[model samples]
Target: MRARALVGAALLAACSSVTPPGLVLDVGRTCEDIALAIADPDVLPGWKIHAAALARSDEDPAWYLASDNPDELALRRVPEDMPGVDLSALGGPHEFTLTRGPIEGQVWLTLDREDEARLWRVDEAGETMLAGPQLTGFPADTSTGWIRRLVFLGQSPHLIALPRTTRVGEVPVHMAAVSPELALGERWTLTAEVSCAPLSELNCPLLWEDLRTLTVLDVAEPGSVAGAALLVSIASLGEQPDPQMPPMFQTHIISLTVQRDPSAERPLLTRRDHVAWSTDGPVLPSPAQIAADPLGIYVLAGLVPAPDSSGANATTADYLFRADVLGAGTSGDSGVIALLGKDLRSHLLQLGSRVAIGQRTGDWWHVAPIEGVTIEEGIVGSLEVGDRVTLLRAGRGQVVVVGDAKPSRRVRIACADPDDGSETGGL
Candidate 1:
């Protein structure tokens, strides 16, 4: 029994001493050496060790090292004169562009005295078309409720509704009798009057009471209902009353919900007295870029949250969250799956497994396992981990990991006694 106990202790000690292999490269190393290892002739093709090194090199250095070290530094210092890649040449609007595909649709805008109307649609070959100059008494800022279905409260008291659609002409809609909001397909329209009086003077004192009601006549529904739903989120702005002095501004999440109505003309959309999401305090600055996938909508906001705070004054941490229409009230779980520590600038390409996070304070990017411990250094360019570690190139990117790869387990034994080696042990 004592002999067995000794063998077990030895095995435990041996296992504990065997640390997992860490990053192969150090900070400040160039991509040339790491790339060479990936293409080495001596290393067996598809070997696990070689693959892991390659994987680590592909991620954005910033995300790879954010958790590894507390003191964040800049990864690469590109010269100001260096020729930067022009992403705008990739064939898309430099600013935000909303379209189902290559086709142009209808856009309606009304501001003060000018009511500009244009019809846009994409052809079968993916071409965009712009037509018309419609006029109305609605203010252009009021159209905020229309574009992207994202509400942006204007500086003035005017309410805007801009809904893009394929159909043209004035459709008989009695919105004043029923509700002041109407939802058609992916677009939602609001028809509300502007009030010069401050909200404090109203008897209700709440913005919801002052909203005008809108009603739609004949309505048609979309063909598919599978992934179609409306989401609504409300946030409050302004100062919280403090007895010590004047009130101070603080932002907070007020409400989030998802609705299943075909038109999305629920009662919640009529609340104009309340503040819009974009106007809420703790405002998130404009995002650098925005994209959508099966998972959710991603907005690459430039501001990065400071650790241990509710994102009041952190400059290094960028914010990424799933964008949803406020009235839709879809599941909260759907937005912003991963909050990366690095800035949006470091995220080169975010695909399945391979992600490139830019590192701080070095020419080389830090590469590490996407699922395991984060590695921050000045030498690595990109990092990935799967069946093996991999290092990505600065110019050439790597494939994203869509799923996990299981590793094969093998057992080996080394016996100290040659004579006793002949004895066999049962599996």
Candidate 2:
């Protein structure tokens, strides 16, 4: 570990040779990007990034601060509201405040002995616990102590599989969304080595310095993802990859063209409140609504296959779940984000689908939908696909299935090894 840490520091120095000296951490990049950026060829990847830290840094890129060592760091805990088991019986004397038990919120862990480790809550409960193998049951590279003592407190043990290497630099790592906010993928980078840079000086921010360690958060970005509230006419391209345009589809691509008039079937803006977008291209729309005459506009909407896919193009439903509306948009290519109305959203999700483009006279462009768009709780709409609708977080023999970020239904989950328990068959 010590040798790797030194090597990691060397790699960081190498980064400075390539990157400008003033900005050690590229604030413009995502946490995942920065994490991979600072990785050494032999460093091991970590499971999670500090969410709170990322959020803060995003708001203030200049405020890149150092944090507690991730190895010595405790994993965040499940929300008190989130379902979890009561392992209060698994108590100990090494625990400074064993009374509260291993409660919820952000946390940390340390080895108490060879057989047991301590779990500490960084929240109000101030709980703690002495855990065993089942707790460290995650599949990390034991050689580097990746998942050795650390355990994220949750209703169920979740396993996060990572890649053996990384596509370092500003490259995009395709990922499957676990929820709207969380996506899962592997970092095919080197074994990780933590860096030893102090924060008091103008040393690179702790967050970026972390990349110097062997940690790569499993997240996604297709170079960049830009969303727009485009009002498009729905249709399907032919059943094969169009010969001239790099074979876009195998079984008829879900296709679209710009629709100008709101009266004759319009495009619905996405996520935000407004609804105008560019008709001349697949460029994402700006915040303010901009209306342009939607005549004679043609942008080639291509469904680039997944990084490893070589089969038929996605099904109509599949295409919608992986929608990519951004493009090298042309001049006069623009749109808005205003609310075209609730009914329009419904029409696009349900009614507006399966129809031919509104005005069929000119060249056509296309796009597809990705999974889990937002909708109000009580008033619902269909996300449709089963896999896209639910995601899993695994640990040991345990798994957690999240329906969606804001699921309306009640959920329950239980985990932990029962053999070590005193009561029953190890509570």
Candidate 3:
């Protein structure tokens, strides 16, 4: 019965562009399950998928896959029927998506240009709705390309264009929000210096962070978006590399919440809250897709194993990882959790909360939470040293469960009062 239900969910996701909230995971599911659920359906081999937008055709809710080929770009409707417009003239689409707007679905696209960060809104047939007056203060870098992402905020409808770093190691620390009307000459300031030398393999510094995905929720007003989340990937040099082999890169994940101050001349985007996991060794964590629910944020990612002592590579492990956003007070008795290995894939380490299911090659451990440890039960636990854990949410009275399977042994997630400096030992 469970297998049948899983298949139905996968089929529904494949047929629709919208990601389901409860599709994060269940017991006995792996990370690849979520990855495949959110992955784009197979398009023609040459075309690179740029974005997935809501289909403009119906009220029932469907999606269109926008892809780019060497010659031009096109939108292929899901379930494969409706013919879409040929967008060859858009000039190599950077970021494009359809958002709920003045009418219903507005197709927005950003162009690949050096002087200006171009924003274009077109119809389902690819005819322009509004086009002009490039976003001001866009970096004019000829050697490198800039990537942009767009999202709609509230009923008053403010369109936000977020900039990706022009080069690796350079984090674009600023964001902009434009009203429904495409106001001209908006400016952005750079908070960090671009130090990455893409060509120089050995000398270029490795510590870097890049934005992966963005989600907005609980919009109080056109200017006040309460829970705007950004999934970021942070990379650093794992181990000193041999002169011959390329350096091993260790990647980590970060969930950042930014607040918008609408009162500023140009609405300022500032960090409000963040959850990060400091891990040991070099594990290449690649988060391909991310989304959120009322509970927390979830990421479908590929975690590549660090190179062994022999310097040989291993297959990447796909897993779905969750970060607690809502506190236990609202989420009820217990929340989903899982225990993952330090090496990305191996024997399970200290049982931790948050659901993380890996590839088939790893053992799925079963464990139970020790009750009466705290009012939140064993949900709020102390993070162990060298374990990939994020205790940042515990300060907010959040509890995360570690394992999903019905197991015999008892495992306790220690509790710590962030304010009082009080902690209970793990069992």
Candidate 4:
């Protein structure tokens, strides 16, 4: 009986995209059960009554829960309190069947062959299905030859093909195990490095072994290229070349293809060195941390002193620049670069459009503008080793600098907000 009901429900769900305006269900309600009830109302004569109770049980003043009683609770049903279910898990509820009920009483179910995960709706019309849990499975290993690398292109509720597979004109396949937490109209790409074994050890000896690159594409449409953001890049470092040597290692660069306009000549933008090693050793950056920001991605490459190197021993003049990502494919020298700061090793903070640089000479600590020029003198007062300094932008073009001084430590130049005009102070 359950088998027949499941099949019938599946057929009904496949046949229609619209659900009646007053049905509702819980977050984890089985589709097979709902289908049997929906297809033949007699199967569950009091299903609507149970749905109403469930709706009222989960009602909150913040949102309107679906319910059978429009006057008492309104025409919506409360969502069921199903543990371990998340809206992000449902993949936006595109393929589920919708039913309405109690104040928050809407229900949805997945037709996916893998799991019994179900989606819930807040309304009976099924126009808005809530998210559920993601199904899982091992993706088929379809490497015709030794796999070199894999890149992620775009993610959707539907399955996606691996980047290398797509390149070879193979049918796009998906790794059913990983489902991203994405919004509607948002896209993602994942690039994976399968292996880094040297092709030839006799002629060209490779320094590092077991290297890989993974690049992710968050947005791909041509019209949205500039707004497109990189989620993250993950790379694994090869073992240290020499245990006694100063961290020698090789890096595998992951490139991204930024899609421009569909009709434009060459809608793809590729960047090499998008992923690089730190000065210490070859280690890939974390993709989870990289994807957290929506504007741009940054990979820290350690500090480099200015070429002059004068006063470098006492005080180094280092400039921080964005790592070159164009690799060898760039032409005409128009590439991305970060700003330069005079003294960054001591105090370094990058927030929005401003960067804070701090320095201590004798008793006083001084700060300078990251961009424009400023004139300020040294060590007016003393400060303790662990004193905290906070700088706030003063009104009317004025700069406010605050210093928390420690005992026995005189006020040195605590903070510096460089104004266009000459400003001098002693604490």
lDDT per model vs. reference: 0.24, 0.19, 0.34, 0.27
**Which regions of candidate 3 are displaced past 4 Å?**
1-50, 55-69, 75-86, 93-103, 112-115, 122-128, 139-145, 155-172, 181-227, 237-246, 261-287, 304-319, 324-336, 339-427
Q: Specify the poorest-scoring 10-residue window by lDDT in model 1.
A: 1-10
Give per-residue CA lDDT, model 2, range 63-85, as digits (tens): 00111343332223332222222
Candidate 3 lDDT, 181-212, residue by residue in tens = 56533445533232334586564433533333
Per-residue lDDT, model 2, residue 294, is 13
Q: Cα deviation of 145 in candidate 4 (Å)?
A: 17
Q: TM-scores across all candidates?
A: 0.31, 0.18, 0.46, 0.30
Candidate 2 C-alpha error for residue 176, in Å: 21
Q: Which ten contiguous residues of candidate 4 have the minimum total lDDT?
A: 4-13
Write the number of the candidate with greater lDDT, choosing between 2 and 4.
Answer: 4
Best-matching candidate per lDDT: 3
TM-score of predicted model 3?
Answer: 0.46
lDDT of 1: 0.24
**What is candidate 1's lDDT per residue for 1-427, written digit by digit as tens?**
0011100101101113333342222232222112211222122112222111111222221100001122221111011121212212222221122212110121111111223322222122222222223223322344322322212111101122323211111111111110112221232333322222455444322333322112111000111111222222222234445666643332211112122345645323311121122221344332233322232333333433224335554334443344333323322322333344442233322222222233222222233212111212221332222323222222122322211243211111111123443222211
Leading candidate by TM-score: 3
Off by over 4 Å in 4: 1-129, 132-139, 142-209, 213-228, 231-247, 250-255, 258-269, 281-336, 339-427
Better of 2 and 3 by TM-score: 3
Residue 63, candidate 2: Cα error in Å is 18
Model 3, CA-based lDDT: 0.34
What's the distance in Å from true for residue 173, model 4? 11
